[model samples]
Target: MVPIFVIAGIAIGMAAFVLLIQMAVRNGIRMSGLIDWRTQYELERIDDADGGKPTLHELYEIAAKTDSAPDAIERNVRAKALDYIESRNSIHVRNCWIVIGVAVGVCFLAMIITLASSPM
Candidate 1:
């Protein structure tokens, strides 16, 4: 029926929107961590002479070599950075779950509507 098709179309569109929002949130969380890590570690200076930035693995190696056993200031900064990153990640994950829940609910509603409107 037309109503069932309309409901399904709307549900599909909303599900796609929810997925896009989840992806954006996930990417934003990752990018925020990357930016914070780069700033905290002065990763710009770790680049090759040809101006190529180091890969994440290389950056980890550099950090391992340089950042052993935190001093007082370093310890405080590390703790704060970790707290910020964790909070951001948690918030993003929560939002993603909400979107996923909505998508699933929409699909369920569409299915119910479709079945109810169909002839036996």
Candidate 2:
């Protein structure tokens, strides 16, 4: 029979791993500034005095400040911001899932190895 302590250890390890993943996602998004830009604001348009590529923060600032919510420029900025955040989040989720899949596969393989090697 499988040991109760082994089962408990696996359960605790999985729970801890899930909690770590959750905390990583929360901290990663916040650290990347995606969390800050998630808002409905009435700021002001950011002038590109240098006429160069504005940062995402600047675009967000200009995007939310417009009086007309759906104007071409504002809509474009909004779309860009949404796409940026979504893409970043997608990447993080993909990575986490891949790691989980790999870990599960390794554990499964280890179990098979042990079961096959054991005497009948």
Candidate 3:
């Protein structure tokens, strides 16, 4: 019975981990065409969303509105968006990992209690 509980706990933990990954993948939709997964980290610092850095797209739009050259603004927006996507995605992934870890712990605890209660 203990082994059964342990196995069940393990299965639940693995499922939670997979669920976390799925959530991360789903969140990638926010980047849509703005980011390609391969080169996202190069465009912006993932550690610094609050770095007061204006998004490239926002800069581009603002500059274009102010009669500045459009080309650089467009390029920067695309690059910045890519960076944002990468950084945000990484954050999501980290959060999910933590969630999975917690879920595993909880499942294990539940399993232990369950097995302890079970008897011939």
Candidate 4:
């Protein structure tokens, strides 16, 4: 149905807006440089202190071997994991926003043409 298509279009537009906002957040993090520095510094320290560089999965094994509190290890690991997750999310958000923007633009044009022809 036409109405259904219009609704879908609007939904796509809203999706785009949310995605764009997410993209902005990701860019902000990159610009702030905290994620990069923290991730790198922590990884380097982890490598140096733990005998060698550990892949992310290996961090768990290293933590298990240490006498230190598991909580601290888990916390640091979670932080690193989140950085990776966010990096991926940023890309998805950017793509969604672009698709949504195109949908909304097309919908708007359709609405304008429909409205102009109506004899109200």
**Top of the candidates by lDDT:** 3
Candidate 2 lDDT over 62-107, as tens digits, reads 8667645657766778677566556555655666776676657656
Best by TM-score: 1
Q: What is the TM-score of each candidate against the true structure?
A: 0.53, 0.47, 0.51, 0.39
Model with the higher TM-score, candidate 2 or 3:
3
lDDT of each: 0.59, 0.56, 0.66, 0.61
Model 3 clash pairs are 56-77, 57-77
Question: Under the 3 Å rule for N, CA and C atoms, how many clashes does model 4 have?
Answer: 0
Instruction: Residues 1-120, candidate 1: write the lDDT tens digits.
Output: 758576676868676686867677655756565566535333333322444444445645555676775464455455544554455556557767776677677767777777777789
List model 4 lDDT by residue over 24-47, tens digit each.
765566545576544643444443
- For model 4, where is the 10-residue window of minimal lDDT? 44-53
How far in Å is the alpha carbon of 88 misplaced in model 2? 1.7
Per-candidate RMSD, Å? 10.1, 9.3, 7.1, 10.1
Tens-digit lDDT string for candidate 3 (1-120): 667777777788788878877776766654464555434543444445576766454556675775566677666566656666666767777877788778878786977677677885
Residue 106, model 3: Cα distance from true site in angstroms: 1.5
Model 3, 37: alpha-carbon shift in Å?
Answer: 9.7
